[model samples]
Target: MAVIANAKVETLPEPWSGAIRSGRHQLITDKPESFGGQDQGLAPYDLICSGLISCTMITLRMYAQHKGIDLGAFQVEADFCTNKEGREWIERRVHFQSPPDEALQHKVLDICSKTPVTKTLLRSLEINTQLV
Candidate 1:
């Protein structure tokens, strides 16, 4: 059984700090001074959205390749935001830009749903956090 899990622990204060890792990729993060960070790498919110977008595009490409579908010309663009519905994240808008096709729009959307990040976000999650 293959399991995918990410762990990030706060490693700094003020600007905030954390080390996040997934698969073979590991990264440290902080916010900009404007947001309490020292103008480090990507912002936390950007990281979150980018993770999802990457998974969606990768999954789409993988699925297309498997079915002998040509994806050399495939393209995708994704955007998202954090919006709490009363108290929880109940609504999200994932905009995508791919080759327009009347018959393929549904197929592409279906493939996107199978992305790991999509599944993870749509499913319940358990996060343990505390001040360091």
Candidate 2:
């Protein structure tokens, strides 16, 4: 399989904080104060949600543009959830500044389910970690 993306995370001076480098961009990840972090940035789960949310938005926008559809402004929100059986999942919602028609709305919903990140999360994934 081809590697689509790669990231490097290094520990920071602050407790529970990490410096992340991916592609040409850099960002920080940290837990909230309640979790003993200084709340300097997004937590681990938040970053996961962010990836899904961003991929959804970008995929939708590209589809709309290619179809010559005006979607206007939109936002995607995702929340990590754990059920009683301890199974983890995510609840994602999309809101448009100006709502589209019923047909378009249905199409958008379908597109959301087919985003790259969405598919990745839905399927079984094997993460292999090793020390170099």
Candidate 3:
């Protein structure tokens, strides 16, 4: 597959903090003070969850517009969890300010499960890293 996106991260003088650059966007990632770093920004797992949540919402909105459905306002919440077996997973919840009917609700949920980020997370992924 071709490269769909790219990101570069560099460490800061502060321990456990990284400056991230992707396209025209820039952000920081850091461990919390409890993890021995200044709580400067979201940690890695939080960024993952943020991606999933945002992608799901955007996909839903796009689908709704295409189908002429009014979702009004909605919120997507996601949490990262580890089971007793040490397997990690994400739990997601969606709430609509103007709830749709049962059939539409089911359809929206089905679409959520198929969002781009959700599909990526569901499948096994390979990451190739190298030092330049």
Give the number of the best model, judged by lDDT.
Answer: 2
> Taking the tens digit of each residue's C-alpha lDDT, what string does model 3 give over 45-117?
9999999999999999999999998899989999999988999999999999988999998998899999999
Q: For model 2, which pairs clash?
A: none
TM-score of every model? 0.67, 0.96, 0.96
Stretches > 4 Å off in candidate 1: 8-14, 18-24, 73-77, 83-100, 128-132
Model 1 clashes, total count? 3
Model 2 agreement with the true structure over 1-132: per-residue lDDT tens digits: 798999999999999999999999999999999989999988999999999999999999999999999999999999999989999999999999999999999999999999999999999999898988
- Model 1 lDDT at residue 113: 75
Which of candidates 2 and 3 reaches a greater lDDT?
Answer: 2
What is candidate 2's CA lDDT for residue 120? 97
What is the C-alpha local distance difference test score of each model?
0.66, 0.96, 0.94
Alpha-carbon lDDT of model 3: 0.94
lDDT for 100 in candidate 1 is: 40
C-alpha-based local distance difference test score of model 2: 0.96
